[model samples]
Target: MIVFFHHLTLATTTTNPSYLTPSTARCNSTAVTSCTTTTSIIARCQSYEVSWNNHCYYLDGLGGNCTTGYSLATNAVLGCIATQFASKTYRSTISNNCCVWTADTYECYGFNNNCNTAGPFSAGPVWSGAGCLSVQQRYSAQLTFCGSN
Candidate 1:
């Protein structure tokens, strides 16, 4: 399952009328189709939105960004993401998608077991742009972890 808090603007280059509407958008982590089609999610609002048992947290809204350090093929926390969230109120410890331990995102990852596990572990690096795709692409780190230490 995919869960995100920040609002997003879909496709920005299209002249189609649907682009003008506000809703959940779909963009290429690279191609970026249109911003008009882009919907809204979040802006300055940051919080730990937990799903399932508590694994899925919407890592957006924070002043900073997030990313996974571990890999699915092998467990390793080598990457870096924004630990500073706009909220920075909680200490979140992020794990990779595989459930391996990862660096701290200033908050804890309260995820449930499989089946109920929050999916699409986004290793945020949420960027500054006109829209979601305009910024960075949040891919599943295949990493997973609990909240902070």
Candidate 2:
């Protein structure tokens, strides 16, 4: 199992209102093709993968120019992980903090203050695909975040 531990610099103006909130879903995957049965299960597995990939992308500052900065964050993180580990299992431990600017136009970044705050958090280990012959390997992905108190 591969492991990654680091802090993400996520800062934006108040007008942007960016929060370091975790994804609602614990696990996500992509759609599976060429499957005749157990489509639902396959879909779930795919969703988990997709969810984790997106999370990685956003954290790496590749989420693109979105109002909430979600898109950029997801893309960056995903791209970084994929580039390094083409085909390998890895776990990530993320340090979560809410940083925001004082004004909409001005940039003043800080964490866990009146201007910035934290949100609900959750983390778990992700198992490789199940019931899908295409992905019959034992891999695990664990993600944890340090919430701002």
Candidate 3:
């Protein structure tokens, strides 16, 4: 039987990035490498996790979707913009932290401390990239809230 493989990396502009999954079936403890199947990759991602840029990310704050995670989430200090993560859910286990944007990188950076605001929603998992980063590194790289649909 010929088994077709699904490539997880979807072609997307930074302005509208799509959720990615493991491209390979067998992945090392570090990166996804050559493999002959795809089931392993799919299993790698958790229920609350989504794959992107060849790695697993937790579902955090979301942009666009015509809805906000919390009341003050739209504040300028949060740097919530209708950019890459717009219309899509941002992955993180942290709180009202900003998704720091650099020249070529945009990772959710903050702590587990919730913002001084209140709403029907709550912060998502306090993840550190689901094995993507060390626990100690989580201090600089935090997660986002899991907003409602």
List the candidates' TM-scores in order.
0.18, 0.17, 0.21
Give lDDT for model 2.
Answer: 0.22
lDDT by residue (tens digit), candidate 3, 1-149:
99999879878765422122112222123432232222344325444443332333333432211123221121111222212232233443323333322111233223233322233123422223233222222233233322222
Model 1 Cα shift for residue 38 (angstroms): 6.1
Q: Which regions in candidate 1 have their CA more than 4 angstroms from the true location?
A: 1-30, 37-46, 49-93, 97-123, 126-149
Write candidate 2's Cα lDDT for 35-62 as tens digits: 1221233212221133332232211111
Q: CA shift at 34, candidate 3, in angstroms?
A: 18
The positional error of residue 70 in candidate 2, measured at the CA in angstroms, is: 19
Give me the displacement of residue 107 in model 1, in angstroms.
Answer: 23
Ranking by lDDT: 3, 1, 2
lDDT of 1 by residue, 3-122 (tens): 989988887675623312222323323423232313343333225432221122333211233334311110011111223322322224333332222232221122232211233333
> Which candidate leads the pack in lDDT?
3
| Candidate number with greatest TM-score | 3
Q: Which model is ahead, 1 or 2, in terms of lDDT?
A: 1
What is the clash count for each candidate, in the order shown? Answer: 49, 28, 10
Tell me which of candidates 2 and 3 scores higher on lDDT.
Answer: 3
Q: What's the alpha carbon RMSD for model 2?
A: 22.0
User: Is candidate 1 or 3 superior in TM-score?
Assistant: 3
